[model samples]
Target: MNSIFKRTYSYWFLLPAAIIYFIIFILPTIMSFFFSMTRWTLSDWEFIGFENFITFFQEQSLSIGFKNTLIYAVVTCTLKVALGLLLGVLLTSKIRTKSYLRSVIFFPTLVSTIAVGIAFSMMMHPTQGVINTALAAIGIDGPDWLGDTRIALLSVAMVDVWKGLGFATVIYIAGILSIPAEYYEALQIDGGNSWHKFWNIIVPLSRPATNSVIILAFIGGLRSFDLVWAMTKGGPGFTTDLIASIIYKQYQGGFYGLATAGNVILFLVVTALAFPLYTYLNRKEVDL
Candidate 1:
């Protein structure tokens, strides 16, 4: 009985944090669920069943939002995994300026998302932007990055990769560095070259890092809003409309219930996609 009491007291240390979690996250989520089913103002709410949800789905740009959200998540996640691994391996190798290079690569990540978006938006301008100006100097015409319907999402995805690659590379670096030195030494004794070392050891062992990068990048891409808003506001005819952005637009239009419904849908969608993905990736990690 005394031991159990001691253990209970030990667990009490988590009470404050748990209470904070309940108030900050659990409470708001519950409120969102409730408010999502209502037509509400500051003073009162009228329950409307699932009408808000139905109207949310009936939105003209919902399809585009879903499409763009998926594409953005997939593209950014893939690029971050591949490019990050490549950079990680390179940076982990014997190089004099490795520390400086690592810092340089990570610099963009430390910048504000909105700032990066705004800066890139200006840089990607069709005519006078630095990117286009440099392209013209090289006798190439750069397309309108943010204004184009087709490539706008891709452009934003690329910027996301640029911003996120550093964190992914850092994860990979930690994974690679954690590998036993004897593994490389044994491979060398077995007449294994650098490619063998990387392929047999680094790629396989670093998969945990890859999985982390994929999951984080995918979720972040799905929830991406500020950058898109700052850059194009889901413009160019919904080319880069993401679920989060659509919710913001709804809120902006003063349809609070509809917006909340969209938020709930987004939460459900992310939960649906993320859990399966996480489970599958973790299973792969275990298999590996």
Candidate 2:
């Protein structure tokens, strides 16, 4: 009876969370599949077979959105991993102002993203913005940031990396801290310098954290909407339009079914890529 009671209690402990997950995640996802096959509005929906998906793929904006989304995800994820690792090493180093510098670097992640977007928009303003103003002072011209199609996506991506790098750095710090100090002490005993310690000890032991950061950042970049929308609205002739932005525009235009289909596609793309990549990374981690 005591054993039975313990099992019951364990199940009860999990009940609330399981129910919440079903209600919030599983239910909505299942419903989305249904909605993706129908034309829907607030009060009404009608079955439309695969028409929504067909239209979504054929839409001109979607083509650009797909391309931009992939590019943005790849670029931002790479920079965040590379730069975050660098910053993590710096913060963990025995340097003056290390604690203060870590806080300063992390402050941007705590601020409101929309506020960051707006502030950066103004800062990158061609004529009077601080970035261009500095360039002008150096006798160089700054390109129109969000206004120019060529660089608008890259500009948004840079902001994303800035906003997210701190979180990645924190993750790396945790990973690095978890490493046994004996490893570093041994390296020191071997007369290894800082660069040698980093290359041989820190990099090898931090694989798990790197994998986590890469997957999370890549997924976030793929689904990014708010900052891009606030900064460019996928504008300057659809140059910066990501998949999420395109879906949002469709929803705004009352193409409910098509928007649902777009969401479905986004879900599939993220899941498909993320799962395989996660498995590969975990395998590599085990090998490490």
Candidate 3:
């Protein structure tokens, strides 16, 4: 009994954290579920069943928001994974000023999201912005980056990648450095080239880190709001309208219950997509 008590007693230390999580996250989520079904104000709420859900779906921006959200998530995740892996490999190699370069790469991530968004918004301006000014100086007519509906979401996705690339790189760097040196040495003895070392060892062993980056980047992309809001506010006519922005629009128009339903839907969409992705990625990791 004493031994069992000692073994289980360590779990008691988690009580405070668990309680906090319940209060902060779990409780609010449960309340949101209820509130989403009601027409409510600060004073009172009347349950109107799933009318909010129906109304939310009936919004003109629903399709646009849904499509843009998926595209944003997929594009950002793919770019972050590819670019981050490449940068990580390069940084982990024997290169001069690697530490300084790493710091420079990560510096953007330390800045405020809104600040980055605002700064980039101006930099990407077609006529007055530095980007086009430099382009014109070199005899190239720059396109309107943010104003062009065709590439507006892509532009934002690129900015999101820039902000997040460092984090992904750092993760991959750690993963690469954690690999045992003997594996490489053995491969060298077997006449393995850099390609063999990379394909056989680095790629397989880096699965854990790659998986973490994918899951985190994907989830962050799905929930992306502030940067998008700060940059374009889903502007250029719903080109970058994400689910979160749609929800905010609803709230702006005094559709509290409907907004709550949108929030619920966003949560559900993220949960549904993220879980399957995580599971599949984990399976890959295990298989590797």
Candidate 4:
């Protein structure tokens, strides 16, 4: 009777969260799958199996969006991991004003992303922006940052790294701090320098944190829309259009079914890539 009562109480505690998840996630997912197979408007939907997917793949911009999203995810993830680890090591060192510097670096992450995008758009203006002004002072010409098709996507990606690296650094700091100090002491006793300590100890022990940062940042990059939209609006000839931006454009143009199909594809891509990478990284963590 006691065991039965405990089991009943445990289920009661889980019921609310289960219901909420179903309502928020599962229901929308099911509806999206249904809608993806139809031509949907506000009040009417017609069954059109696989047409949306076919159209999506046939679109020129969709291919560009997929390619850009893959590149953005890979580049941003690599830079964030590399730069964040460097920043973590520096900030965790016995340098003065380290905490103040950390706060300053992290301040951008707390600001609204749209606001950041707008502000950066202005700053990157070729003629009147502060970046160009500073470049002029140094006798260097700054290219049209967001307006130039050649460099627009990369410019936006750099901003993303700047905004997100602080959080990644903080996660690294936490991971590094949680490691036992004795390892460093032992390394020092054996005459290991900073390079040896970092490569041999810090990197190995921080694998879990690095894994988390990579997955989160990669997903964020893959789904990035707001900043790219506000900054470039997928403009200068679709050079900066990511998959999320393309999907948003579809929705805005009243292609609800097509947009739904894109969303489902994005979901599946993230899940498929993230799960395998996550499992592989976790296994590496255990090995380490």
lDDT of 1 by residue, 10-75 (tens): 968998999999999999898999999999774789999999877766766765787788888889
- Candidate 2 per-residue lDDT over residues 39-80, each given as its tens digit: 999589999898888887787777788789899999999999
Q: Give the TM-score of each candidate.
A: 0.93, 0.93, 0.91, 0.95
- Candidate 4 per-residue lDDT, tens place, 1-288, comes to 999889877788988999999999999998999899999996999999999998888888776887888888998899999999999989899999999989998998999999999999999999999999999999999999998988999999999998998999999999888878988999989999989999999998888889999999998988899989989999888889988998999999999999999998888888888889988888788333
> Candidate 1: deviation at residue 2, Å?
2.0
Q: After TM-score superposition, what is the CA distance of residue 32 in candidate 4 from its true location, in Å? A: 1.6
lDDT of each: 0.89, 0.90, 0.91, 0.90
Model 4: ten consecutive residues of lowest lDDT: 279-288
Clashing pairs in 1: none
- Backbone clash pairs for candidate 3 read none
lDDT sort, best first:
3, 2, 4, 1
Model 3 Cα lDDT, one tens digit per residue, 82-200? 99988988999999989998999999889999999999999999899998999999999998999999999999999999999999999999999988898889998999998898889
RMSD of each: 2.0, 1.9, 2.3, 1.6
Query: Which numbered prediction scores highest in TM-score against the true structure?
Result: 4
Worst 10 residues of 1 by lDDT: 54-63
TM-score of predicted structure 4: 0.95
lDDT of 2: 0.90
Measured with C-alpha atoms, the lDDT of residue 163 in candidate 3 is 96
